[model samples]
Target chain A: MASETDYVTLISKDGFSYVVQRSSARISPVLKRMLDPTGAFLEAKDNTCILQDMPGIVLEKVCEYFYYNEKNKDARDVPEMDIPTELCLELLMASDYLDI
Target chain B: MSGRRGGNRIRGPQSALTDFLAANNISAAQIRDDYERRRQQAEQDAADAGEGPSNQTPEQNDDEALAAAAQAEEAEKKTKKRKRTEKDAIDKIKNAKATKKGKGKKKGKKDEEDDEDGDDDADYDDDFGMYKKARPAPGQFEHCDICNKRFTVTPYSKEGPDGGLLCTPCGKELSKDVKKEQKAATKSAGTGRKRRKVESDRLDGIAVGGAKSLSQLCIQKVAQHHDDIEELGDLPPSVLERLSEIFSKKRVMKSKTLPLFLRPDLDSVIVHDAAYLEEEDYRQIFAIVPNVRKLVLSNTCQLKDGAIDYMLERCHDLRHIQLYAANLVSEGMWHRVFREAGGKLECLKLSWLDAAFEDLVVQDMVKYCPKLERLKLKLCRRLGEDAVTSISDLPELKHLSLQISQNVSTPVLVNLVEKRGSGLQTLSLEKFIDADDSVVGAIHDNCIQLSKLRLSENDTVTDAGYTALFTDWDNPPLKFADFNSTRDIDNNNSGGPEDAIGLASSGFRALMEHSGASLRHLHIASCRHIELSAFMDVFNGAQNYPALEYINMSFCNRADTSVVAGIFKSCPALKQLVAFGCFDVQDVVVPRNVALIGVPRAQDAIEQFGIGIGVDEAISRMVEVTT
Candidate 1:
């Protein structure tokens, strides 16, 4: 969806792939470390990383947040982010895990 | 009326009325005669209709206007032969003359208003006839109130003077006018964002301006929605610790949310606030994580004997414990913990114990916890001289911090220092004002392994004593030191004895010379006897302190611009320099990356000279400005 380059593909455990800009995905330290081009991990060569512990629904929301964070990185008084109630626990764990 | 100046005449065409007059062959006499006939006809009709049209209501205007239009429509055939002299044509000429007169005085006092008293919307509508139509919803087409151009209406459309919607350009013009008026109201309110930021940064702490990091924002969001969080699964120990801090800070760490922070893999459980946590909630901590080795619980008002017993029984691997305001835990339970878990305990810090923890329990703690390495006892009112004398028995105490209420004897402190000072890496005995120079002499004599020292809030330690303490001492350079308020506070004798009661010239110079390289943080606030010569001599640009980063010299008088500049010259690594009450530090530019707190006029230099200037450039600018 994002021209397949300058972006990274995140594959959730439930087999859903999200295409997000590498700059947007750089908000997470885990993703930054995983997508390091210099590192020889399989994710670096292929521009794709598998989040084995996350589901597709939570991963989609995480990608949305990554882009949102990138767009308003230097902004102030930003509006509160929209999140679903059912995924609050899983998302908190994901954010903590990814160190978002 | 026609005797106007030629220069004031139309450059192009003045009004539509004049344009029609130039085009028409008829003179003003013809129009006056036509108006007379219409007036007679209207008077005869008014007598027959039993009323006059003058001062009529809007309903009468509508009725009379419709009748005139019908009459003109019927006479259209005959008027065509008379060169368009219908009633509507005469009305057009009259309306154009009125528009010209209104435009000359106040351009665009609305058309309806210019027509005067009884004129209705249909009688004086603009060419587009947009105002007379029903108001449309947002996203529907409407005409601009001023310019009469059609545009789509939106929720943000500005209203005109007569309640019609304004287009985007008119809206912008209105906003600009409003802003100009507001700006005119208060010129001083233009304090730039940078100055406001600097002022906010000086409220006794660091101010990190800018948006929070993404992770920090997410963590705050997680804390905000803590009630909905079912579980915090497999978060790292450090992240979990930070979450616990946030939860406690928000007072959201009740029994319901306590389990989310508990994980068996985390050895450290820090609950910064526990006011709402009862004894069962405290026991739940031990029940969840029996392997917790390091525990820090503050505001532990309800942690009772049962929780302590459970913690002592369950956590066999507990090595460090720091508790604050745990008054509900009795002295018997503290003795039990010390007796049972003493062999593995490596660090213990307790404070605000007013009712229970007494001298005997402290003596027993020293006897029991042999492996204790760090001890901090603050505001424990029951701790007296006996507890003070008994602390020297701990064999492995490398760090000891105490702020007790009682005034212990000088010999007892000296005896304690003589026994345990050599092994102490840091010793903080704050607000112990009764001890004299003998204790300082003892620290200088017996202390060799000390790297951090604080003997602040004392009136008896003279400048000579501090000089002797640091003059030829064998101790290594300390990394942190705080000797604030070590002054003689006599009302009648403001300045101390001629030799200077507190830290003076030679003592300050000697301390800087000894530890200037390794000292990262030095707090000498309220040490008023520290003279300018000592400050200048210590930071005179010849010596370079490579690692000194922070210094607080509040209330140290005579620290003027020269000493401040000299400090920037000497301590190249200094980041935060605080001189709160020193009024003499004026007309100095703050170097880049260093926060100069408590200067009122600092914004003049920081803003005028610009940010991130080199230290030398800033110092030179200060000289230039002063001269």
Candidate 2:
């Protein structure tokens, strides 16, 4: 029930969804295109995007990395974020898809 | 329970197999004893079978067969025992040797520690002892870790990451890696080095009040007092020279300063840098410095035929004229200039003349300028053999440099040398493609007073020619000799035992033997055919070049680290060595007084033994400031 203007819901293949701020989600070009207000797609109307090819775990890590990058965009020394070794490959594939 | 079961079993004759199983273990001695007993039984059985041959039974034959098998088994056991003992003895000897080597290493370590302690107060004399200890044993051999091949380990052997020794191939690879790493580091550092301050930045410092720029203010000031400006004729020559320098530095020397210096009274007007002077300004120069005896224009890109004609008409007292990059002056104008103004010309230097300076001009200059003592014609590509031959007409010419003239052939060079060699002191025929044996022979036969001879980049000259030139020649020992790139063409075209056409073993030896005593500077770079054996032989032991100071042997592929060491050992007064592409020289220890350039590993040697800061250190400091 989150307002469409404030946040966008991103759902993975496993139906696990994440509600991120509209500004933070816009950091990723793919998400920004999907949630564009002028677009005629269902994602733009509903303010929710379902990434059918990405796993839930990978999508969650991608969302976290996007937020981390947004918060530290201008920082010189950003703190290292930990990603599980098993999830690294999946996260890289998902990031490439999202163009982040 | 097993023992009780064995007791309940019926017992029979104690066979050798049963005895072996009951013993629970088998020894070599036991096997030998059993074999001997069986062999003796076989002999008894054979005797019994022979005695009762008529009534021999199957059981008796079987016993005889078993005895024969035991005898064969016994022979095999004896051989195995002998082999085991031999192996055991070898292991014992190896252990003893290992212990001995360990002890020797410990003693060596102790001696090194003692030497280090004693070295605290040691002087230069003790350096020999320390050096001897530091050098690895020459006869020692070690296996290469990469290929597991045994090779003679020299002092120059490279240590792997784990302290293992590498052979020559692997060592070369590692050295290349080090060079690549150093190159990358220096390249990155070079990017951060000090950038030259731009002209705008310099102007920024001079601009005041921010209302008007410095140039605008200067223009206003000059225009306001244009009539009050003093003529250069009223000022002394020193003040005129200083003003010319300031004007040139500010790039305002073209027309503005020309009028100030162009007066009828001045005899000598020398602008230090007149690069911006156009044709009109040059005309004014000739008009103002009418009676000037010496006129030196460093950069005359805009100078034309009209300016030269003006100079020839007005500056008749000019004895010396040096023009650089004066390509605008045409051929006919040059002929006219030489004919009119060449009467008292003593020194003429025309450089970077791309057009109109050819055989006709040289012939005119030779015919007119008889008093010319020094003449240098550089980058005048149209000059032919006829012009070169015309140079022989100058009887007073002591210094001549004809560079980049490809049309001059061997016979003409020889003729020129024969004609003017006696008076020539400094002759540099650099990049003349046809300077061969005849020219070298001509120089040797005639030029006795020659002090400096630079015959660089002439590929047609052979080793025999060089040998003939230096072998027991009566000419005075040269003070400077540059034979760089003489053998480069020979390396590419010809294929034989003496493929390198310029200088070989005997030629190099003769040159060193003849000129080693008085030679001050020698550059034999890229003389690829100069054999290392000849180099070593000439510089071996007490054969020293006392006066030799600077030598560049860059790109001499045969000259390796050993040849460099030999040069250092023989030449005590050497100051600079440039070994740019001599790849065989690795990890060479240069002398404290000598400056070694283009050597990556020499950086370490320079840091250890050099007097001033090394090149890398200076570059890094500059990089730090700029960054």
Candidate 3:
């Protein structure tokens, strides 16, 4: 699960950087810019972004899926699961933080 | 501005006076002083010239006094001439009627009365008091201040002291004191005259006497002939007490159908509640006055079924009829009104009616209201492309509101905009459903002067529509680098940018990419999900749209702070952004350009941090955030 300490670096289109934590990013959607495909790595670039509320584990999973989705160009829908209410809240927080 | 007076379109002396008055914002006292000075100067000039200003010599020392006397004499002569004309016409009609009715029944009653009245006229010449008494009573003389004509009273004022007293002219001209004395004398001598007049009246009957005398009477005679004329004008002192009692009892029912006293500038009485008038009431009301020029109906009068026929029958002089919320306005009603009074109606507002009847009625309305300039049919659900298309054909139509929910689809609207673009300045489509890119494009292309466009709840329209509408169509180049790039891409790239990779996957995107900076207001309410690519095509590559002062991205599911960051970085002057119900709302990243952010206390979720990020801070940022 994501914790408050996890952070992400966001770069604006003009190449400015802003440091944001996962807990703070969980309430904002700008953090989703980190999921954009550049090359092979998840290195921050010159783009707009914030942070995410998802646990560090969930953030890694989402990034992993984002990577594969970009590579394969997948359009598959996310499957429904019996997710705990707290985890669902964490997902919404992450979605909110990423603004996606 | 010069206007017509006395049947002639001549520039009045007042026009020059107005010019003088307006030239220097002259005060009334100053104008009066100037006028007096001019008059005195004219007098001095007359004195200096000696042979003296043509008509007036120095012998007429009181030139003003002389002029006034001459003018009074001339006015008196003209009044006498007018009185003769009126009296001759009336006498002729009265004699004709008297002869016609009293052909065989000439027991010589009315003839005897006339001889007595003639003798009384002679007596009026001698005593002047007797002449006044012999003149028609105060109520007996009827004159219209409007037409400046006289009408004989039906029963005559035989009951008062001034029975057969003042001639219509004299009664209108005489001082109140002289009139009162004449009234007193006529009452004193009323005995024999009243008897003879009543005897003749009984024999001739009210109707026959009325017709003979009425031919000499213009519409003003109706006021004298009204039921309360005798009760009002020459009522005895004792009768006044009874009248007040009667008035108090019947106050509600006694409301005037059309007020008798009219403002001088208003030439006609506009009966406001004509449509709601009962049949008998309409007949009585119209029968009372024959010179009404305009009648406007009030409220949403349910024409029911037969009311239109009844209204048409009685309202003969009605030039304009406004049926705002009438029920039962069918094709037949439209045809009937048009056929009856179409030549005079200048304005027609018939918006609230059954939709099924609107088109047919509108067609007939246009055909009939030849002088019509304003037609308002807002929310007439029955009106469709046929009505809209036809309405565009009217040359005089200046305003129209075709706000019906229908397939007022692109083609019909485009045709309308093209046809009536210049003439139709105000067109409202408040609840229009089929307003799309093509419709907006046509409006932008053809309707150059259209200032207000109301497409309030129309959700089908996208941002591309605005892009196409606001961007100048003449600027896009046919051969471009993007075009070549798009064509060179693999055929299998389904999701790749089509030749129009700028906005909305159409020429609209190209237009926005080139000129999205021109958009002043962009409303994307209920546009489902916001597309990141479309947003980029508009705000990313373009700089001019500046930051929109107002952005209504309400109810859009995909609104995120990244979009906000883009807006902040690009649009430096954004004043108001209404993203209500935008589920994806996050803390907006304040751009560094604005040194300080004025975040509201209510938006506690947003926090500020100082600028500057060290290289060491970059590597541990992700790990620090993940903790």
- Would you estimate the TM-scores of all the predictions? 0.65, 0.48, 0.32
How many clashing residue pairs are found in candidate 2?
0
Model 1 CA lDDT for position A100 = 74
Assess the local accuracy of residue B295 in candidate 1 as a C-alpha lDDT between 0 and 100: 95
Model 3 per-residue lDDT tens digits across residues B1-627:
112213565543565666665443333444477789889989888778865554443322222222222222233344445434433333333334334443422423333333443333322222232222223333333433334344445443222333343334445545565787787676655566664543343233221111121111211232223444322332222232232323333331233523332222232433433444454554444445444455443433544446567656755666545555565556676677877877777666665565345677667767777777666676567777788777777777666656664567677877877777666555555555556667667666765544334445554455556556656644222111111111112358634333222123343355445434544445545444336565555455235456345455555445554455455445655544555565554544333212212232343412222123321242235235434
Q: What global local distance difference test value does model 2 have?
A: 0.68
Q: Name the better of 1 and 3 by DockQ.
A: 1
Pick the lDDT winner. 1
Decreasing TM-score order of the candidates: 1, 2, 3
Query: How does candidate 2 fare on TM-score?
Result: 0.48
Single-chain TM-score of chain A, each candidate? 0.93, 0.91, 0.34
Best by DockQ: 1
List ranges where model 1 is wrong by over 4 Å: A1-100, B1-206, B601-610
Which scores better on lDDT, 1 or 2?
1
lDDT of each: 0.77, 0.68, 0.45
Error at B560, model 1, angstroms = 2.0
Q: In model 2, which regions exceed 4 Å deviation?
A: A1-100, B1-274, B283-291, B404-406, B488-500, B601-609, B612-627
lDDT of 1 by residue, B240-284 (tens): 888898899789999999889888878988999989899888888
Alpha carbon deviation, residue B45, candidate 1 (Å): 51
